[model samples]
Target: MADLSSNAPPNQIWVAVKKQKVWIASGILLLLVAALSPDQARDSLGFVAQSLLTTAPYLLLSIGIAAWAVATGADNLIARAFTGSPVLMIFLAALAGGLSPFCSCGVIPLIAALLTMGVPLSAVMAFWLASPVMDPSMFLLTSGVLGFEFAIAKTLAAIGLGVAGGFIVMALAGSHILHDALRDGVGNGGCGAAKIRNPKTVVWRFWNHGDRVEKFGKEAFKTTLFLAQWLTLAFLLESLMLAYVPAETITSVLGGTGIGPIAIATVVGVPAYLNGYAALPLISGLMEQGMAQGAGLAFLVAGGVTSLPAAIAVWALVKPRVFTLYIAISLGGAFMIGLAYQGWTLI
Candidate 1:
């Protein structure tokens, strides 16, 4: 018989490394330990399960919204509309993003595509910052998990920051920064190219167009593929967070006394890039343990906005200066909002 260990494939060599084996073995051991310690495992598992559950509704809503936006060609129309007037574009972009239910990852690709189609950088930035926080899915989750008052507060805070940040970016960078990167005539292409029928003439097209079934099938396939690619990275990040971070750590850092908690929470959250679903349990736990509302809100905004994947994606697509500006704007906005929440509560 062939020597099984000696004949292992090259790919399996890395997996057989002592360090890797030890790490894997240690992980299994830790899991067993946690399982034996029912109370600790229960708390940790509960936190992760709750996080997943809270995020599920928002994920579904966001995917549906994104699919509709793509299928109806609303994305292109909105980009074109914004190109006409910079100020109007900023407001409309934020409004559209705020109302839609897309998470940060789901929205990033769409925003990147829009930028590639020549949408204003300021408007794109506003949408990036606002969408995850103000979207209906987030609103529903926030209200469901926290309460209506907290949801309303979050919505208003996100909008205010989005608008203000858009204006600031526009003033500093100029609209030209975005137009230079976009594909030529991206928005100007007629909807006919995509075989999109006018909403008013949908009935007529259904009756007249013999290939309507084929066209519908094509649209569905494209939308599904687009959504799958969009969500893949985000889902991976959520899984990692669920697997690694401890609930007590989240609660302690975010719930500590004074501005220190807010600062620590912001620092921890800014780099995480988790969706509200992955973040909900952590935030709820902090709140339940007497973490300041303002700090928890800050963590949510920071985590929602500045994901590492989105940052890397942005960096690859835009100029270094532009990408740096994007990160700064998001961080600054989160800090300001957190500060405002703190101030309001103090008053």
Candidate 2:
């Protein structure tokens, strides 16, 4: 047999490597970690493996749903469902987002699907801004750790933050200030408007058509690969973050009153986020250490919405403009919500 493994041209090989950049970066980081400290490397890799295992079921479901939408042509229905009543849709999205089951990192699939399906960015923004903050289980956990009042306040904060952010996007869109939401090569899309111009009739029984079945398989595989690569990198970075950053360092800076501390908390929350389950106890401990109530709320809201992992996933899905607006809304609303909550506590 002729050894013809290097068949691809150099440029094509470079393009392929660029596409796999996240995986390459992940490998490099791991190698560096292993070289520097084998124990830390082992711990971080273990964390990534465990996180992936925990997230597997949700990832599979998301992939299946995404693939199903494409195969069955049900994406049009999804668009109509979300865009039927724009104002109502935004409100409902915010409300539903509070009860969403997805975690900060897991919400990316739906966000991408909604954008790809041409769902109005306003409603999607509402859902997008809110989904990461609080779920029913998180509410319970926050209640147990921080107290029922604080949990209720956080839940309300999630809904309110989303509603406000949605309307802001809607207003910007009205002024033509908002840019095209999705990125290139995301999904049957360049911009959502162009794709939804000629909506296809959804065939619920898509399996009856061989082409549809093939489409489903391809979509599923592509989605699975895309999500897996990004998710692995997200988890790997998250693992490193948790291992290196100390809780005391985070709490120390956030433990003071006024807008100054709240402002600092919002900024710090992005890099310092320890995930919902771990952060509650940490925040609770910080409160006992004199962390301002406002700072705590700001930290929680900011971290939940724009944590390193969640931000990375969002960056992968949307254009830079949309991502910037998303971060702006998160940071601004988190601070305001914190101020409002602080006022409420004073009263």
Candidate 3:
């Protein structure tokens, strides 16, 4: 009566997948068009090259900001002052988050630091919710691609998400909502949080520390590489969409100011959004194809908040309830903002 399943392989096999997703995707895309003539293949390569070129400026900008943020330890320093009234702390954290140059991945260490330092969960929630949406670098790039007004609106929306998420988390304090947030090794200085030191001293004597220089070099390279991979994927996908997806089809579904289109955009954004930098060019193309402004904005917000990488980072640090609430606030805020923007356009 030996059970056959006892000697079977473990159901969850941990596969060590390489990080060459862009290369793999590009290879598959080329294979899909392998039947094309040489000239068509050349044209397809040209499209991808052009897409890279189009995103080059933003890529450079993002690299610079990411490098500076890491070197200065500015984000962690900002979170050190989160000991005030709940409302004020939330506002400060959210504001600092909106201004920070870190992406969702970059913000994880800072969030861990705040939680470990006993900063209110509400304030940390605000920063965690807000930091991914916009930063100075993103603002400039968005302005260049989507227009100044759109950039401004999106920045405001980022801050708004922080404030709203802060208040809601604060209101739900003392319930099961805030329980068991700091999981094992999450906030106990495990996420590579920065040490607090005087900024002026660090900046003035920056070259004296060989260790920091080495760390900075590694961080700079890592940040740049990450951006290149995601952006390449984004550019390739956008090129395909432009070449294949009909403009009328996009416009027909996403071009309206009605609640239907807004809701659809929000839902689609959760899974479809790539990165804030990549979303710009895609959003630009969608707008050219007659996407409504409100819908486009909704998509950006939803995607930023619910991006797969970002969500995974948050999930690593908090319990299931807190993670679900994060998503709910992001979706609700995105939808409400879209509706409000659409209403304002009529005024």
- On TM-score, the stronger of 1 and 2 is 1
Model 1: per-residue lDDT, tens digit, 1-347? 22238678765665556424433543564477476765655555454455556555655564454444444434444333245588887887777656653424444445556565556777877776676566665676677667777888788777776787789878877455543544333343233223212222223233244465455456556544443333333333334444566657656666544677777777778765455554665466557656778887888777776766556656655676677677777767777777778778777
lDDT of 3 by residue, 57-121 (tens): 76677677677666765545564447679889988878877776654555666667667767788
Clash-forming residue pairs, model 2: none
Worst 10 residues of 3 by lDDT: 8-17
Regions of candidate 1 where Cα sits further than 4 Å from its true position? 1-36, 42-84, 102-109, 174-258
Q: Estimated TM-score per prediction?
A: 0.63, 0.60, 0.84
Q: Best TM-score goes to which candidate?
A: 3
Better structure of 2 and 3 per lDDT: 3
Q: In model 2, which runs have C-alpha deviations exceeding 4 angstroms?
A: 1-83, 103-106, 174-177, 188-256
- Taking the tens digit of each residue's C-alpha lDDT, what string does model 2 give over 1-347? 22225997777778778888878988999999999999998998897787668656556766776677678876443334355677888987887677644334335555666777767889988887787788765676677657889989999999999899989988888543466667787764343433245556889999999999999999889777776676666667756656676656655776555778889888988887756655665576567656788888899999999976667767988878888999999999999998888888888
- Report the candidate with higher lDDT, 1 versus 2: 2
Candidate 3 residue pairs that clash: none
Cα lDDT of candidate 3 equals 0.76
Q: How many clashes does each candidate structure show, in the order listed?
A: 1, 0, 0
Clashes of 1: 1
As for lDDT, the candidate ahead, 1 or 3, is 3
* Candidate no. 1 TM-score: 0.63
lDDT values for all models: 0.60, 0.75, 0.76
Predictions ranked by lDDT, top down? Answer: 3, 2, 1
